[model samples]
Target: MADNATSNRKRCSLNAFISHAANTTDVVPEFPARNGPQRLVAAATKQPKRRQKVILEPGHSALDWARLKSSGKDLRGVPQLGRYTLTEIKEHRTENDAWTALNGKVYNMTSYVKFHPGGVKDVMRIAGRDGTKLFMLTHSWVNFEFMLDACLVGFLVPE
Candidate 1:
């Protein structure tokens, strides 16, 4: 009965060692002989692939501005919308006809007023006025030139 108790204790100790090793390592240890020791072999692990960063040049214009340039008589001799006075811009103040000046450029934002992410009130607050300061203060990172290309009315006439 003493030999049986010793054999049971040895088996329990071997099981505890194998459990600890399997939990700590990636591979499971194999025991060829039931009464023998445990041998652990590590399993191969695949490392994650790293991604390379792409750098773009400064002042990169994604769109071709040359294509949008007016050439024919469709412009009614205006030749690229010319320039607009503050008084002319102020004429479109209501929600039905909203216009805004930003960075010396005029933009007819009537259609975009309701669709503004910041809300119509925010857009209306600067209607028919120089919104360059307010625009930069709130959303300096926004690419207005590319996003509002179709909404552009003209450049502001120099004072």
Candidate 2:
């Protein structure tokens, strides 16, 4: 009879110890806290920030462009918005003063060429012409509207 009682006590003690250990995991961490899963998902989903092969000059980074946009510089060049014929737009082709149309909106792309991810050559190719097709083909993801809002010259009207 005594042996039976001792056996039962040992079994009960083992179960109690297991239960305590299981419950203690909630209070005492088994492993360190980490966002491992979140970081993996983000790394998989996030697109590359820069697609350019050429390195940008100092003070001409993407952040610099954002700062330049807000700096109150007259990026538009013109006093007010007005329709521009393709002929007139062609005249402003130089890197010093470039104008191009994308999605029917004309933007003064002079200052932006330096900030371009694809370097000046890529942006210069679109100068003084309708770059909607080329721009879309190269970097369709680019949000030109938002990027060039401050540099907006006007709409591109038929000549």
TM, every model:
0.49, 0.67
* Candidate 2 lDDT tens digits, 2-23: 9999999999999999999887
Residue 6's lDDT within candidate 2 is: 100
lDDT for 66 in candidate 2 is 99
Candidate that scores best on TM-score: 2
Which pairs clash (backbone N, Cα, C closer than 3 Å) in model 2? Answer: none
Writing each residue's lDDT as its tens digit, candidate 1 over 57-98 gives 332223322233232213122246558888888888888888
lDDT of 1: 0.68
What is the C-alpha local distance difference test score of candidate 2? 0.91
Q: Backbone clashes per model, in order?
A: 0, 0
CA lDDT of each prediction against the hidden true structure: 0.68, 0.91
| lDDT for 41 (candidate 1) | 22
Model 1 spans with C-alpha error above 4 angstroms: 1-80
